[model samples]
Target chain A: MALEMLSPALILLLAAVLIGLLKGHARTAVVLVAPLLTLWAVWQIPDGVQGTVKFLSYYIEPVEGSPLRRLFATVFAIMVFVGGLYAYRVARWYELAAAFAYAAGAVGVCFAGDLITLFLYWELMALFSTIVVWCGGTPAARAAGIRYAIMHLLGGVVLKVGIEGVVVGTGSIQIQPMLATDFSTWMILIGILINAAAPPVSAWLADAYPESSSTGSVFLSAFTTKTAVLALILLFPGEPVLVGVGLFMVMYGIIYALLENDIRRILAYSIVNQVGFMVCAVGIGTQMALNGAAAHAFAHIIYKALLFMSAGVVIYRTGKSKCTELGGLFRTMPLTTVCGIVGALAISSFPLTSGFTTKSMISQAAVDENLVWVYMLLTAASAGVFLHAGIKFPWFVFFQRDSGLRPKDAPWNMGLSMILFAGLCILLGVFPELLYPLLPYPVDYVPYTAGKVLFYLQLLLFSGLAFFVLLPLMKRTETISLDTDWLWRRAAPALIGLIERLLGSLGELVARGRVRVQRFSQRIAVRYLGQPHTADREERGVFARSWPIGTTALWIAGLLSAYVLLYYL
Target chain B: MANQDEPLHWLVRPATIRKLWIGLSIVLAAVVLAQTVVYIKGYFGVDAWFGFGAVYGFVCCMLMVLVAKLLGLVLKRPQDYYDDPDKDTGHGQDAGQKMSGTEERGNGA
Candidate 1:
């Protein structure tokens, strides 16, 4: 009976196919309705694994339902709806179709009941997401997509290996709570961390995301890393390593984003930063931390997507994405400016926004657990977040010196999408109870105490002050900062080039040696064989020498007598 | 959108900007001053000091910016650093498509 119920992820996948083939209004109708239908389907599934298929001596559970799964799936469905609204008119058909398929993979991951199903959906996300990246139609986007693919493929391999190890070691593919204590588990954790945009491998995100078309990045921001956070929540909660890794990602995002100039890249790095909070919370692994992780992931999807949508509208209108190339845009695009600021504020965890309600729980977990170090650093990061995202984003893009460019505000569809998500950001922030029940664990936290609100305001406002005081130092230059991705994007190719040169020289040396050997052998042949008719030399040889005939006759006679005597003996 | 005929948007007027800054400073000062009255349940000893949030927030923001600047000294590069003309391989599926002379889209220098 449950199998008869349509899986929401399948609905989206089917819609992706229809989007690819259909034309005109028919396609738009599917694009708009699919996500809502998926949302309904997500709610329809009952708790626990409801659908199973047997394969290779194991039953794969393809569908499962829980508050956590539903929470992520609901937000994902909402993101698809808004993203479709924003991009349906602008994004290429292939991109839209691919993005939908990619999203379906994400939802699929959310419901995946076992490691096999998870890995399959993971690869699906990887494949279609690459198509989405290439849809940017620029060489950099194309190349970045490849690098992204390589990184994910590597991650997939690690994950698959971990899954196989688990299946063989335990003889089951069921998703279960596990620690990163063993090699297999560590692989799974690392694989998921890669998608979470965890450090060292995190560069692929910023490298590829900002290169995508404006609408594409909005979709890109929502699914991949958040799914990894979900996986970490499922598999590696309470793993202490993530605390350090997450903190590093937190600081890494801020510093890099602070140094960044591209509007989208700044947001891109901040994705790593935002996901860092969730990962850190998951590492704390208390019920509160888990709730914080899930809730933050949910809230983050809206505000981050809203931020990207705002940036997309700006780019769509102005054909510019760099802060250096853009300034004083609020003069022309009031709606876009306001939405950008709201998204920025939400991201900075300003009071009465989604971020403030959700992100504080992570620090609260640290405080409860007596992770004094984590709490301290996270607070510092909170201030830094305000500096880089909250103030810097809006300050440069909207209110800095005028650039003398007047662009129209977002089109009707884009504006509608921004308003939708911006409204959600505030609603969730103002009333977090709407989100709390959806979390995997029971809720026992209040985000808006008086002291808490005042503390955050003081922290955030002073950071704003620091921003202005250091305004000169924070100038947006037309530059790109290197990331670990440089190892493959730049250093790997350069390394290959160096090795090629070395190999070429080695071949050249061997060729010279061969030529010298040939010349030496040719001399030996000429000396012994009287030039062999190929040498093209004068015929003055040892046997061909003058007076050689008389000497040859005497020697022949003497040798004949000696040969006869020796033969007789 | 502001009216195009206006010489300057009212928000950007020098006088408006000065007033806004003054107002912003007052608000900042008041928020910090409110901390002295409001009992903040500081998590640690050092954080319980009056104006701790303001001082720490300002100090941390300054440190982030300065550190970012220092990193930029080594990490920042001309945007075109990665746009190698010789990238003849590793662009999966598009290995040989013409570089398409499309506008660079600010992806590189």
Candidate 2:
């Protein structure tokens, strides 16, 4: 008997539906088993487009395979499994459903063969991820979810316009490498960049992700931006503008993270920083750089999830998200503390960690290309990464002065997820051979040369030194740092209020004009038609008085006689 | 909650941490010294300078911290700056109270 095999996305989506319908343990079983099944399905798909159909005039390739696609899909499936484990016990039933839907969207995007298929999955993510944010169920979460939805919906519209433009301009809808030369491609780039948390509009990431439920945030940390990186790698590689854009994001992330007081917010800003490295690598567009970008994204999702899972544990146990309110957690939550540090070190690209294995290739690419200034700036940004995220996160959240809050370690499942990812971080770092082969291109680079290790160690350690030396200055405050979101969040509303007030005054002026016109007409009616009521005639003023017909005739005759006399003269 | 007299975990004690910091700094300095005996390869001209990574890392970090501090003057606002005044009680509420609220909303975890 022949059987139809569903795409991995459909498998997860179906599981989400089943989970949403059931309660208690059945839902959990579906939640846990669904991702494993999806992973198996992901591995089963062959090397080319398998699921193709004609929709309207276009051929839709929903199941496509390549090393890059498989690489991203593999990590995504792992994320679902791990993220599901972290979230299973704590997350609401609906949140689990939404989260699975979100994951399915991301996996779908990874396997999409054309822009149309990509856009479909892209929007599915935009929608469900917002629901995941809303699952926080706090007033702040509700507001953040609305803002998140608006930003992504706008991005969706832009992307749709771009796709339509491309389709109309050239009669193809296939996903292929593109340049940002024409308006359509530029729109497409901007659309993807928004999801990637690119500048001026990057505020949405920090504003939303931190507000999600702890478990939701764990899922939130993985998918959306990394998928955007995948999209960029697929299209617009070697676009020179991305180099500048990526650098801006790197420094911006560091500065903002340093300024942040909320521990989760710090992590959120660091996401921008890490993704910046990937974006920059894609801009480099060399085979090694592309490999670096893909490898980094793969590595990044694991470690970043590990970090968020740790933070989630803290928030779960102590119910505080701000660094000022955290600290001394290491005393009670030793496992979480260690896991978080591992994640932090990996994020900092520490030697013998996943980051070192993946992130250095981009810098090496910069060197190979001999882009002097870009190389220097990227090197410095690496140190900044170590400074802001590497030391700052662990120190403030785990080891700062005792806040008298002693939270217990994470629950077993959450701890298991952390350990799995932490082990992966170290494993991938120590054995880059495993990850390198999965990369899109051939691997010729050696990550652990003696000289390279020494250089990185020196950079990381001194950055550590600077952190302590300037420790007195890194005090936490009860403040929020404003960003470009303020343009839409505050300024747009303020402008609307200003316009409303201006219109109010205009309405008053119109009312006053109507009153004057009413009075003038009343005067004209009395003067021309006379006051018909004799009883009120005595009360009438000069303008409202009746005029005699003879006086009017005599005035008209005098004006006519003057005109005739002047003409004769 | 003030357990000042309670013996801390040995790894986290103030004295132990201080010693640890000193040990780490010494190790870092030793690595810096090793750079002299074994010169690290550099792709760019500036990277070839002895102790370049250490000096650049430190200076860049210092600049980043200082610049961030300067930005604080303009960028920082009260924690409840964006909150609805009637809804949010700001950061002054005790952690216990806020935590319960978060938990009640099913969002603390």
Candidate 3:
């Protein structure tokens, strides 16, 4: 009966299945309704209710009361709704189903109170997200999906090992803040970092996200890394190493995004960049920093999804993603262009957008902690965000060289979703209270101020000046930029090939030696054991061949006499 | 849908600088209005300043475009960079359509 009451996770899971059973417009309607139902269920989760169950030897607790968890779950549920609307018409029912299940996993993760529950939901998220990637219905999509799954499963394995160690060592599975001094904690941190797309393996995000279907990318962009961020915040908050790691990721994303030719890849890298900010905030470990990280995750999901949806529409209509192949489409798809620009501005942290409100708090915390260099780097990264995502994406996709393609605007459902998210971005930007109150910590920080606002304007505007003046240098081309991933993707493969060849030659040498040794041993055995002169003499009778009868009688008598003499002696 | 061959007018070309200015001004006005509302709601304070975030955001975007453009000069191959121009393999359905007649030699066999 309680299960029948429909939790947010259950509602979304059912909606996904129901959508798969429907067709065409009916499927679209089902997709739209699914998120709303989940939203209602999220709202119904009563405060301070600790939902738990015992299975096997472990206690699974998914607490449903914390403002932080509620905030994330709420936005996740809302994202599913908006994403559903954006994708309803074009996407297959299976994709929609996977998307909802993925959203449910995210929500389920938010409420997971114990390590076991968290791990379960975390792997589930991986499963459904992989399905979403495969639903792109392209060869590239399939390949990307496989790569995505491998990376996620690797992360999951590390996490499972860490969880087991922690349970064994601590004798408790409560989800609590952990220090990185011990092996188990370090294992868990590594697990979370992998999901966050920290360096070396970070290329997976850019590599796989763009290959997904347009609608699929929208869902892909929001959930995975952010969930990792949440996990990190829950376990390993305040680890100073994360600050450096996060900063590296932020700058790495911007640089690579600048070099990327694909529009979605640019956005994908920005996801890394944005999550970097959150990661840094978590490292800061102050109440303000934690709050900032939580709030940024909330806002980032909405705006990033909006950007992806806008791009999806363009790609859907034009069948081109490269900036060089596309341009000046704003003439026809004005609404999409506007919505995209809005998303772009928000991502760039333009004042009065969701980004400005949510992202600035982290920087402020950095300043408070007197992390002068980190603050400056973050500020520069903020400027770079505008350059890569704010201007580059919109400029190339909607307002560059006229590609002479006259495609209709995105379908009504897609348009409506974009409009809704665009409005939310602005709304939260103007009214930070709507989100600030939902942070895990008490809200004492203000987002809008004269001095801070002026300083940010000066910094960002100069960055814009730099971009326009150097336009010739920022042209789009069809090339993949190399990163740390290149080591594994290219160099590692080459190294493996060389090693294989060397091993093959060694194997040949061993075979030749074995043959030579076998022949030598056989020859020696034949020489020592052969039947020859000795055996023939023994078989032949004494003097039988010549002078047989007469000589034999005399010889016998002489032999008898010799035998008697020998016996007496 | 407008015809592709129509003569270019100032208002429509680049969607017109005038239109660009107008649209940008409208966005600016909207931002101002939103700020005013926040201010009235007592949400604006020492933390909620627009000038810095706006200018910073704009400059950052411009810089990104420039960097991408510079990279493009070196990195951008021709439109058919990945495809073999002379090899009418027809393996790529879209590529086949784009390269119907030209049979130039491919760089990498």
Candidate 4:
């Protein structure tokens, strides 16, 4: 296949390969330019399957275009560009390279016209994001990266199995929306849910992301779960099971994040929480709902990356990550503080932020569908989100009881990246028109109606009040909450050890019994085969002694007489 | 580290914090009161009641915190929980089942 027609993802992929070889300005040039070129390529693809090619026996569409595809790809490319801006100065070369490769996979997934192509790109992301986690350059990162890789690879295998099943069953590789009603489709949904950080398997996100390098986490945050959401939108739209899964994730995130101490882990849990919204929207499956999912994904990437960037700067400066270890940073780092607050507000969907414009659409979808339970739960989750992430995060990390930490503001590049995303957050909020048209479907709902604004305002503001009133209860402890990862990291290994011990003891018992039986058999043999009267100390047979022949003769005579007497009787 | 006696950053200053709290409370109250003029159009009946957003938001956060606190009892572990794992594992940590004869065995056997 020609490289040019391969996909826009190739540009970034090729740049990723080249980045390791280049140095200084040349490397910087590639990092900065590649994503933009990809962006251009993304916009150039027109709607529908742009081209089709045969792979072995199956026809595969490597490049396809739709508003949804373009929208997701555009944000991904933008993320790489901005992420490069944020990390180029501070991050290691390998990290930057791995991040680019990981992003290339996400972009590839976006434009993939068939499940085969999507699965290939999905594995590519799984491979490189693991490397990004390892680039954290700590023991924790090493272990977490292994775990992250294992989970994604497992998820990848599940996905591949599902896709194979579907292709075999349907005799096609085309991407089409279907419900998870059968085995293959269920496997496909489950595989996607794992990547989406659904409950039970969701701990991997909170486990791995925080353990990655500051910059690595930013890139890690954007791709994996969001891409899973996209795949869900494409493959399993309107699957009702996702709504409950999403609700669980939403509540799970708030609770875990509220109990968390590490700054990045909090954000990571919230990633699951926010993706929950998109997953639920996909379950809703109406055009407006899908649009909500898409738009929310886009907005989430910006604000989340912005939040991570701010946190990254703080970690970089002070070399601390726990909420308890950080505070009063705003005293010196005004820019990071403001940027973080912007992200915080945006995440909370405050009246004029990107989150406000985007996330509310999901609730609107529920309202339109007359899903009263879903709507109410989503509204409550909105308030819950504001409590944990919007207020709790910034409050503890930037403004709470001073930790006597006075770190400088973010370096210029990091600061610039923050400013860029922070600006986008407000820009999209003020003029959601900037994003709405890019959505997969028409956006009929208005975000800024007075009543809606007042409602959200009250919800978020009173939640902020709840945060303060319950401030004592929100104590930051140096404790980690157990997650499903613990099942493997601790429980599985311990269970294996326990089984081994039991087997070892059982083996010892069997061996002892065998010895006892052997001794008893030996005694019986001695009693029957040996002459006990030969000597007091000798329990051995007398056949080997000098009188052996006489003893044998007497025994033979005694046996003959006994046989004759028995015959007579 | 800055001295404890020094004036706190204005943002965290007690007076500033107190005033900010009051101001934010007023804003919260104002939003709830705005419901009188604007229709929230709740899909659920209970959601349309007076100050539903405010009350619900506060209650949800409180309940969430309470739930988390309760869960913390069972789920919370030291940050180093997985780091060392355990030294004994399943070997000698258990008592009594250890074979007395096994310990007595000579190196030759």
Task: Tell me each candidate's TM-score.
Answer: 0.92, 0.91, 0.82, 0.90
Kindly list the per-residue Cα lDDT of model 1 for residues A113-140, writing each as its tens digit.
9999899999999998888888888777
Rank candidates, lDDT, best first.
2, 1, 4, 3
lDDT of 1: 0.88
Q: Model 4, B44-95: lDDT tens per residue?
A: 6887788888998989889999999999999998666676534433222111
Residue A432 lDDT, candidate 1, scale 0-100: 93
Cα lDDT for residue A249, model 4?
93
lDDT of each: 0.88, 0.89, 0.79, 0.88
Better DockQ candidate (3, 4)? 4
Model 3: per-residue Cα lDDT over A1-569, one tens digit each: 25522346777877778887877767777787878877777776766645566778876666555777778888898999899878877887788899889888888888777888788888988999999988877655676678789989999999899999999999899988988888888888988888899976898898778878899999989888988888888887899989999998998788788887678888999999999999999999888899999999999999999999999998899777766567778878989999999999999888999999999999888978878777767887998988788888898888666667678998898999999999999999999999887888998888887655655555565565566666666755445676566566557867999999999999999999999999897666545543244454433333222445887799899999999999999
Better of 2 and 3 by DockQ: 2
Q: What is the C-alpha RMSD of each candidate to the true structure, in Å?
A: 4.2, 4.7, 7.3, 8.0
Candidate 3's TM-score reads 0.82
Evaluate candidate 3 and give its CAPRI docking class based on DockQ: incorrect
Q: Return the lDDT, model 4, position B5.
A: 65
Q: How big is the positional error of residue A367 in model 2, measured in Å on the Cα after superposition?
A: 1.1
Q: For all the predictions, what are the DockQ values? A: 0.40, 0.40, 0.19, 0.27
List of chain B TM-scores, one per candidate: 0.72, 0.69, 0.49, 0.69
**Which of the two candidates, 1 or 3, achieves a greater lDDT against the reference?**
1
